[model samples]
Target: MTVQFTPDRLAHRDDPEVSKITAISLSGTNTERVMHIVVDLLDELGPQTPAELEHVYRSRAAVNDWPVVAFYSVHKRVSQMKKHIGIVAGTGVREGGAERVQLTTDPLKAHGKITAHMQGGDE
Candidate 1:
């Protein structure tokens, strides 16, 4: 399958994760917050499906003491990020019937500064 991402073929735009991001973060815009998590996850853990991301995100957020968001919200945010920022692409692999996504080679946009709870570098 080897899914390749292009501007015309995006993953998740116009999703509610945008608004959820707004509610969750006090600083930065919705896009900034989503990019922070999505980019950081992919950068740290390699490729993962949105579901995998959600699970990992939940775990990381717990360990890091951050607010927990839903898997569906993660699913929508990952898709929207793939569309708006072009930071992620489908990996053509399915785990639990969902496409695995990976970060692109583009310059890193979110350095995880949007998160205030992340205190240590152990993450």
Candidate 2:
């Protein structure tokens, strides 16, 4: 379960999806943490709407006793993840329906990225 990190062990190296995720250099304080949380949640839940993402974020924030994770924050992160990471894709919806975003890679591939990240490797 404990995957050791090395030059070759980076999630992006072996997986194309992860490669896209890691290709972009994240800037600003705490961006990395936000990206990690978004990736982890997507890996677990597959595709989701912005509202669903907000719900997940709120639940996590509550569990950690952290400040509320605002809906805007979740939306921003999701958008960034789609633009920079490339592992997530969005589907447009009708006027009343919410747009949905999901991982571009298959479940097994996502599992690889998730496992690598969970084990302290980079994605």
Give the candidate number with the greatest TM-score: 1
Model number with the top lDDT = 1
CA-lDDT, candidates in order: 0.58, 0.57
TM-score (C-alpha) between model 1 and the true structure: 0.60
Residue-wise C-alpha lDDT for candidate 2, range 8-123, written one tens digit per residue:
33223444554434433332223435556666677788678867877787778767644443335566556655665556788664223777888888655654554444356656
RMSD of 1: 10.7
lDDT of 1 by residue, 29-89 (tens): 3334555777777888888999888887777776775555534656766775566445678
- What would the TM-scores of all predictions be? 0.60, 0.53
TM match of model 2 to true structure: 0.53
RMSD of each: 10.7, 9.3
